[model samples]
Target: MLTINKDKSRREQIESVSIEQLVPHDHLVRKIESAINFDFIYDLVKDKYCLNNGRPSIDPVVLIKITIIQYMFGIKSMRQTIKEIQTNVAYRWFLGFGFSDTIPHFSTFSKNYERRFKGTDLFEQIFNKILQQAIEHGLVNMDAVFMDSTHIKASANKKKYEKVFVEEQTKTYKQALEEEINKDRQKHGLKPLDFTHEKVKLKEIKISTTDPDSGMINKNEKEHQFGYSAHIACDKNGIILSCITTPANVHDSMVFENLFNKTKKNAGKSKRAALDAGYKTPPICKLLMDEGIVPCMPYTRAQHKEGYFKKRQFVYDEYYDCYICPQGQILEYSTTNRKGYKEYKSDPKVCEKCEDLGRCTSSKNHTKIITRHVWEEYMEEVEYLRHTKECKELYKERSKTIERVFADLKEKHGMRVTMLRGIEKVHMQVLLTCTCFNMKKLANWIWKKGKGGPGKGKNLEVLLEFFSKVVLAIIKPHLSFIEKWGFVNNLKRAFARFSIFGVLLTFH
Candidate 1:
């Protein structure tokens, strides 16, 4: 039975509606607004605005919120985000716009960024603020951290690159390496290698003309392209503590110190760091152990030719300072190179008479050489730690922590490929994307705890209690002086004010 009725009620419907009412109660935007405060943006950008300006400008918070929407929802472009906002009830409510209020033009954010936000650390401040909020909420666990880098394809053609010659940049650990090398040479009764008049070497690299700041990435059997690498450090809870951006050609080990130091400053010292094979170098292992942090890394396969004996087969005799080959031949140590490797050469005459000469040496002289870094002891420690129970368990969390974070950023935050050109712009993009990612996590955590709405005092009591305990623990030994100075009452008042107004209040 089909009854066709011509009803145009949709075209004639006119009932008063509230934008807030149109949005659902459990929407993500509502949770985000409830879990975090956006008022801090006013103080951060106040200097950028003119008080006695010609006209009232759009709220800087609104501009930032607009970009947040673009990344939070994985919208492809700002124009598309604007269109979505204009039609989305939840977005309109989040931005505090009325049903009929005009959504800002898509170009408004770009114009504002170029004029007010360019060359500023505004995005980084926002990211740090959000991360601090997470820390305060007890959402970050810095006991163990995971570090890695993911490549973002640059908006450039692969074939439009120009090969250019440039001076190779010196490594950050060059001075330290030279000192260690000289010390090793001194121990062996040899002269230190002179580096005073060493010339810088020139290297050829491909640069994209369209996006000169991006470097050509040609690894992992992927198509060659210009791209940028985003190095991120995350806690066990998958909360990003710090991020640094560099050209894609930069190795993970090169920027590891900067990234780790930044994370340490923000999140305090971590007990351990889990990394991949790319960060299994001597310098990295030494850096972590020197800072009293255990480094957990996977087993990196030794680089050897096919059908050749592995390096491990040669037993290193530390007492004699030599290596014993599989055929029981002693390879005596010669000299340590500037690259920090101690060379060991076998006797050509003895090797020529060996039955395994073909399998061992391909050189015309029939001599086999093996090299070991002076700092190999630190690498040995790391390899030993890799087998320990604690490190093994910590290393297993890498897939759940940093890998999951990279997947989320790419699939949910539009970080797979960046449309920006320069390193600075791409850095800002990464920061904002990570900020939004943290916000979502914070919001969901709060929501799951049954504190989802605005002004609900989300974990305020818990924070206040924790703060009181920490304060007492720090000043317990000085209680006599506090009592003598009549500060006990003042301390009580301070606690009360903290419980009321949070950390914004200070005792003067």
Candidate 2:
């Protein structure tokens, strides 16, 4: 018989509920709370708060927890996060807010950031502190790190940009490159190229008027937009050791040193670093080699005209200080240019009638030229390492580590686009996003180690027993009706077999 209950008892009934009991034992927030001591946040933000004068303020710990909750759950905006906290029991419990307690407004964080945290390293300090905890817990492995960069679309519109000529900032390695160039020139019996009188080059580029700090990104067939690039370095466990944000137009190699240095300082020395083709430049390879770190990078395709002989075909004779072409022609070394490349030129008269001239040289004079940087030897060493078994295996971890980190940041943490404008604000967002990721990873790892709650094996057993009992209870009432169809006997035999197997497994 079909019947409808007219009871509204539960809706009108009053009951006592404890927030702690409301949350599950294996909840992520509970695990995070047990694994991490958020009390340290108080010490970090103490100086920012008025100790003796201001009115009783919202706990800085709560404020930080609110943001953590926002990123941990991939909430889109602070406003929505605050709204969630207002109704979410677990979030409120994690934040130490009672059921009736008021949640902070979304604007509270913005005001605090502008007045107290802006221009301060508070966000970075917090990030480092969380990373330190992970290190202490033995969750970080810095032996072989991976590095890459991802572009985060800025909040500004791409069409709201103006073309302006800006003086290109001199490279930080300019002096080093100059000294190396001069040394190489002296070795080649050539005069050093003077760089003192070099003009400052001004390049015209699009600048977003709304977010002037962001640059126009137009690469990899992606949509042209104003954005910022986050260059990140991570350990083998995907714990981010360092992150630096710059304009989207900034090349990955441009920020390699700063990011690498920060990672070294934070996580101690790394034996090897796996990089992508964008970091296969001479200077980057030289930097890693000078630091005694092996560079593992993929093969970068050389840019050349179709049907022409590749640069690799012209083998350099180190003893003779020249290049030997396929036709056995010697391309003698000429002057070292200011850009740190040694120009090797072939004899035009000798190549004017060669059979392979078409493949070798297309110049009007039939001369072939190749340029090699002073640091090309380091890049060659990297290429040599690329063929080794150790480096090949290390390079394979890039997808599992740094690439996955970026994917999580974009897909799960809402980092694909920024709601902020300035570079500093965007950096803060990156730091917090990364911090939340580390926190979740740390918490989950600790939980799986049998510290958060019941072990996985025990949980599985408990679930099995509970489900088995519930099945018996539901079938018990229907056994008489089921027996008429000759199904109860088979069901009884199946449960008996399952119960015996469970007991045997438990004893085993």
Candidate 3:
């Protein structure tokens, strides 16, 4: 209140202090410095070269550490991420950087993340790293698990596809050939081949300039879009254990079998599996039972499409082995075990003139055909799952836990479309995005622990001491104005050094 004037002597001292030390003294990113485990991932790819000639685009250890950093902080691009470590006090400290050093270019990050490390198993390595950390931290409850799948867009774009007329298809193909021919001809003067050959046949071509391998499909009765589905298996605490990717057209119901098998391998035999209505089916229920897993999928909507008494209405006669329909009609064995279970059918002669014939059979002269699986007893067990309170609670948690995995990857990690154009590339993208999700969750948990959760004061002190030393120059910008992270000075510096393509090389 007493000082209103700016004097040369007073300003000089402040200027010297500012000029001498622009970096922050207390870095907030220290909370995440030692939180994640990168060694497990580093050990997996230590000998594998990201590039040919025994050269690595990125040291496997460095790549994983930086990628985990980018995910935890929600950094948008690789270039910006590096700049953050260079200038941001918190990031620098967390990344273990010292003063008088340059941050790696954004291109370095993109190159490794999008290109070299694009393999899904590599990402799975990262995910397992965090999962092991969570297990060590006692954050994952191995007793019960809930699984559900949702669509996580591949790195492809919607603009990659457009409807083409049949007549114009050949013309388009010819034009593309002409362009390629011209380029090859003008450069190397290569001759054109015959167009009348029998090998070419396609009515319409899928042309996505951004990502060609990714197909366009509709979901939730919505407009056409490009993407893949993310299938996740998470524990009861909503901690993800495994995730897989499939084409957009692949239904969630179909992927349940393999996903269940993978989850079983990952969790071992003790955990109970929870699923949703989308997973309810006779085939899947039987498989889970064989593996000694408790099935909790809700009844399929097919059970509610009312007509002539759904399968539930057919009462079985134990002593004589037949079905008793609601109309007091006894369906005695007509075909002997042709399609598993005791065979039963209505009398065709009696059905020809029956009053309920119109509603019961597609043909007036034919009786309805119903075949039960040999494992009908397990299906009965599935039906009983709906009657319990615990099952209902598990179903409610299904949406909350699994759906958010997709939303986070798509909305935050720029995983809406795949850049690589093939099933292999798309699958890897799904795996990586899932791994990214787990690392971020673990980072947040570490921060939460430091801020005071169930743990010893001594252990917290030890963690803080170790992190503080590694991240001495971390910058913690005022939290009130953190929304400007996208345009932070460090981010701009990072991007200027590397275009998106340059960044992609770091990953591949």
Q: Which 10 successive residues of model 1 have the least lDDT summed?
A: 499-508
Query: Which clashing pairs does model 1 show?
Result: none
Ranking by TM-score: 2, 1, 3
lDDT (tens digit, per residue) of candidate 1 on 1-508: 9998799787888988777788888899989888888999999999999999578999998999999999999887889999999999899999999888999999999899899999999999999999999999999998999999999999999899899999886788999999999999999999999988888899999989899999999789998889999999999999999999999999899999899889998889999999999999999999999999999999988889888788889999999999999999999999999899999999999999999888887889898999999999999999999999998898888889999999999999999989778999899889999999999999999887765465465578678777667776666777778779987777666666465333322332
**Best of the candidates, lDDT:** 1
- The alpha-carbon deviation from the true structure for residue 147 of candidate 3, after best TM-score superposition, in angstroms, is 1.2
Error of 1 at 291 (Å): 1.3
Candidate 1, residue 460: Cα displacement in angstroms equals: 18
lDDT of model number 1? 0.90
TM-score of 1: 0.87
Tens digits of lDDT, candidate 3, 429-486: 5565666676666656776766532343667567656654443223233322433554
Instruction: Give the runs in model 1 whose Cα sits over 4 Å from its true position.
Output: 1-6, 451-508
What is candidate 2's lDDT per residue for 444-506, written digit by digit as tens?
Answer: 888887744545567766777888777666766776677689875565556565763344223
TM-score of each: 0.87, 0.88, 0.68
Q: To one decimal, what is the Cα RMSD in angstroms of model 1 from the true structure? A: 9.9
> What lDDT does the true structure give each of the candidates?
0.90, 0.88, 0.61
Residue 311 Cα positional deviation in candidate 1, in Å, after optimal superposition = 1.2
Model 1, 162: alpha-carbon shift in Å?
Answer: 1.1
lDDT of 3 at 164: 48
